[model samples]
Target: MTLFRQIYALLFVLFLLIVASIAYVQFTETQSFLSKQMESDINNASHSLGLMLVPALEAGDDVATETLVNVLFEGGYYQQITLTWLVDGKQQVWTNDIRVTGVPQWFIDLNLFKPITKENVITSGWLQLAKLEITAHPGFGYHEMWRIISNIIIVFSILFLIAILFARVGLGMILKPLNSLSEHAQKIAKRQFGPDMPTPKTTELKELVRAFNSMSAQLKQVFSSLDEEVSALRKKNLVDHVSNLPNRQYMVSRINGWLSEPSSGALMLIKMDWLEDVHSQYGYQIRDETIKLLAEQLHQQLDEISPSVIARIAAYEFAVLIEESERDLLTRYLQCLIRTTNKEISKAGCKPNERFNIGIAERLGQMTVTDILAQADNALQRSRQDNKVFHWFENSQQQLFSREDWRVKLTEAINDKQFQFRWQPVMQLENTEVSQRELFCQLSIQDNMLHAGQFMPFVEMLSLGAMLDRCLIETVAKHNLFERNLEPIAINLTFQSISDQDFHVWLKQFLQNHSTPERVCFEIPEASVYSDLLSCEKICHIIRECGAKFGIDHFGRQFGSMTYLQNLRPSYVKLDQSFAFIEENQHNSELCRALVNVAKGLDIEVIVTGIQEQEQLARFSELRLDAYQGFIAPPEEIKLG
Candidate 1:
């Protein structure tokens, strides 16, 4: 038991001892005193009665003797009274039956009275009264003693109950520190520490709590630091540096994490694309400040029970993972975040008009982690088309998902030569049908056809996206002799696709080993550009120094400022689908005009993408677009032996 309980028990033992002592002492003294008083009263009554009767009996007045007997009996304090006269010096006794009167026979036996003491003096006629003896009524002391004892017991019982009541009330306060310590220990077991937990007050327990809290602090410090570095690695392709929220890359990473889960929870991926100017102007510092404030605001708005991870996956893109949280409440939470962040955006030099694209998904039963991530990623990608967050349906999970399946098929394809090299037919109008076309990626899984859209995006998110990408590139390079190709072949590089410090050095070494450096084209997604210009530029410079070509795919999607465009010096700028569709409104289309003009000024050729319709194809041709790719021209899968 606890110390308090032990103390309480000790006090209870002490109470019992005190009560027993008091009861014993009171009973003993009261019994002695009552016995003495009763004895004295009995003696007085016998003496008085004897004195009163002697005079009347000596006078030979029969009527007076009868009257004295009556008075002795009637005015008696004793239970029974009687008078007897000695004849011829013979002793005699007279008394009414005490048992027959109010006294019990058993009580009489229990308090059995011996012959009473007497002191006799001469009356007017001495009748030898000195020879008198008396006996008390049967139950005289029994009833009186029981009443005294019972009263003493009743009083002590009351005192005992009151003391127990007081003990319970006072015990809690005395044991407060112990209770606090118990709660603290429970929290420590769960690895949770914060201000919400109670702190103990007593010296010993307080010291324990302080020690425990310090340990927790150290653990958090270590783990949080580790998590931050992993976060930095995560940010290599996808993070808002200031808020540390996952950017597009982080969104893809979250999808990766979800896809990896045996049972994926709720996925709510939010894209904040309004902070481009903020990053471009203030150099990501203010953009980061804005995202940080927004993250705090968003976290405050989220469900207290809903666990979430926010990362800046791209410079202007933030992805939020709301795991197993309620949908409607999550919507409200997202709305709250949008309102709060946008409200503060202006003060942080980010606009109030910053838009958020949200994607919501839940894993279907019996699906691989990869498929779920694909579903979430596709949902996010599609949601980017709309301003509101979009919930996923069955179609959101594309056909032929999962890396293991893909890897297996890819290996078989690599062996069986099922892999086909398709040219995206990047035709410069100035040079039609040139022996060169930008090499587009195609995965022919026997009968099921998969494109980069099918699995590459999801693979880019996995820890080994870079590995898979490199493996694909190496396989293609190993099999294909790019040394003698007429058109330069473009190989895609993800922001994280090759962030391995060792891998970059390896790639530079590989460039020297295989294909001629001039024949290689390194294509990076413009939309997924790194936030750290210095790091990105340094990498780009390294790739350029390899004497290879560099181009940007999905260039206009980010709608970044022209300043970054000047820095990249890409060989090709792939126009976004929307830009390709809206080519007619040149004067009104500030976005497309800005992109095309900036690319022209930087000597970067523009490639309009997704031009499947004749109208779009016709329009882009009229606008002097550098190249075109889409269904308008039949796409023939290229076969490389």
Candidate 2:
């Protein structure tokens, strides 16, 4: 029951008790008053009768006395009347018996009223004649008591009902505000800090509503500020510092991801053979200028084949991954890139030798990454030996997949529902108990499982990222992951999906009908979140309103403030895999430490991934990270419920 109903019920019971007590007291008082009045009347009547009968009795007229007594008795004013006379030293009496009527026996017994009996000595001319006694009938008193009780019951019953109706209206007015307050509180719990609270007449309730509105406003402002900081950080993390293209780490991940798919591709390595010579001739400033000019030219030349990954892998080497199936088209692009570099170098007044030497290797079917790199290096050495600007390793693979083939394959995979989800456990670092299972979405085409990193680039390019995300969400719900494992499950969302307005709307409705909303966590990429903070914030709010939690995935890679951490106040933040290279990557360790301190101050759980070795686990042991995931424990197959 609600608090309002409980209080109203108690008040109603007390009101009934009070009414009953008052009615009983009034009935008792009325009964006493009627009984006393009847007694007084009887005493006065007996005295008067004695005086009247004395004349007859003193003259020894027994018939006159008897007639007087019978007249009084038959008048129905007395139940019995008696006259006693002294005759020859003995008492003679005249008596009359009268039966009472018109009063209920039960009522008379209940009231217990009795008529008063009075005795008077009759005298004639100062001589005692006879004794006269009169007893008043209790019928009048009984009738009066019944009338009083019936009136009291009727009047009070009407009054009690009126009081109840008034109380109900009054209480409804008072407690109606409480119901609004309850709904507001529920919305707040759902992270929907919306409009101001309703105004109520009651002073205390009005103040409470005002305070809640104030709190919501303050929260919204704080998150707004946090979003700004995160957005700035995300742009900084994705771009290469010197070249303004994607950095080497991102390029490597992209290439490795592409190599995972069953398609023919190529990796081209461009070395600035004469960069050292240029530096020796011109100062470091001129060297930097040359590198920048070279980078701009490469971007311009490769703009047509836009979707390829290009990066400044090192101070002197630039890497590009081409997932094109046709060797002739790939070769043509490489030649064009070389010519653009040559022209840019000439424009910058550099020697022909300082222009560029490029080496390319075709992606052999199922070849290890190490073998491909070695082949590329061999090709680069051959190009430099022959004094040629570009060289390509022989394309030995017979089966080649063009860009169109991959696109069609991806579309078919999605249409046919050729997808699988694997569950990776995140265990508490301190207790070593599984706390949650993070979901990894994969595409399976022709029985070949492809990791998200392998196909997401294509999926995003084709605007299918949101579709993939929804598929994963449905899969989780269909499998009843939470019900079967009794552990929380988290699914990742890409930048494209998060920014898509349509996806957010669909997700909101989906979560509302989901069975285990509270057990589901939506993992938003930290970089993606900053791209459109306002939209992401609204989406996050909707997710929370549906009883789901949000977390920042791939944290600590960006060089920006962690102020957003305090503002968004997500359930947890998962540190990116780079943070695990404690010995080799000092900068990464420092960044991890800074993030950890900030997270600790904000009371957010810090989950570290890529824990493949015990040393890496021990490195983070003292940091008191909340959870650990990755190669430390291979992903287990999920059994559907």
The Cα error of candidate 2 at residue 372, in Å, is: 9.1
Model 1, position 536, has a per-residue lDDT of 58
Expressed as tens digits, the lDDT of each residue in 442-506 for candidate 1 is 66565766655554544443444556556666866876747545777777776665456666777
Distance (Å) between predicted and true CA of 84, model 1? 99
Supply candidate 2's per-residue lDDT for 113. Answer: 74
Query: Candidate 2: deviation at residue 596, Å?
Result: 4.5
Best by TM-score: 2
Tens-place lDDT digits, model 2, residues 154-246: 987898789878888888888888888888887665455667877898988888888888877876575554544444433454456666766
The lDDT leader among the candidates is 2
Alpha carbon RMSD to native, model 2:
7.7
**Each prediction's RMSD to truth:** 26.5, 7.7
